[model samples]
Target: MPCIRDLRIPVSTILGQLATGRAAGEILEDFPDLEPDDILAALEYAAAAVQERELPLAAR
Candidate 1:
């Protein structure tokens, strides 16, 4: 499945930078190809992935 815009970078890589205390501006600066929305999308995608639940878990 598609994870990031244009696949220039993986969402996990973005999350890794974020986890290492990289600011949004820093990320943008480091990855000139990435837009602000790409970062936002990565966060949103991560949140959605974490929020998803299996059928049995949801039923419980």
Candidate 2:
């Protein structure tokens, strides 16, 4: 299984898709190794960022 933390692309991108309406199960259809916990982590990270309104230089 691949590590969600190790995905080369930004987790935020996936998180946004999820937030909009995509399902965790659907995402794993493409990436077989992804887990519910990985989805949860992305959600948590996105929520924290949105709540704090913190925009890092890399994101902007």
Candidate 3:
């Protein structure tokens, strides 16, 4: 799993927060050590992770 600047904060953790309707500012407030770019990077990393890949689909 990818982490934020070796801080041991997994990208999934950030994504989970975002998925729960938390704003970036709110996340930063909760984790004062995190920077805006870290959140952006986590999003970017997730986006890239799912790109150019194919998944199996069941036939109807």
* Candidate maximizing lDDT: 3
**What TM-score against the true fold does each predicted structure earn?**
0.79, 0.63, 0.84
Query: What tens digits encode model 2's per-residue C-alpha lDDT throughout 1-60?
Result: 222587754686676667789887888786776777888887777677679565668755
Candidate 2: 10-residue stretch with minimal lDDT: 1-10
The model with the greater TM-score, 1 or 2, is: 1
TM-score, prediction 1: 0.79
Cα RMSD for candidates in order: 3.5, 7.7, 4.3
Output the worst ten-in-a-row residue range by lDDT, candidate 1.
Answer: 51-60
lDDT of 3 by residue, 1-60 (tens): 789997899999999999999999999999899999999999999999988977799999
Candidate 1 residue 15 Cα shift, in angstroms, is 0.5
**Clash counts for the predictions, in order:** 0, 0, 0
Report the candidate with higher lDDT, 2 versus 3. Answer: 3
Q: For model 3, what is the error of residue 42's alpha carbon versus the real structure, in angstroms, after optimal superposition? A: 0.3
| lDDT (Cα, 0-100) at 40 in candidate 3 | 97
- Deviation from native of the Cα of residue 39 in model 3, angstroms: 0.4
TM-score of 2: 0.63
Q: Could you say which candidate leads in TM-score? A: 3
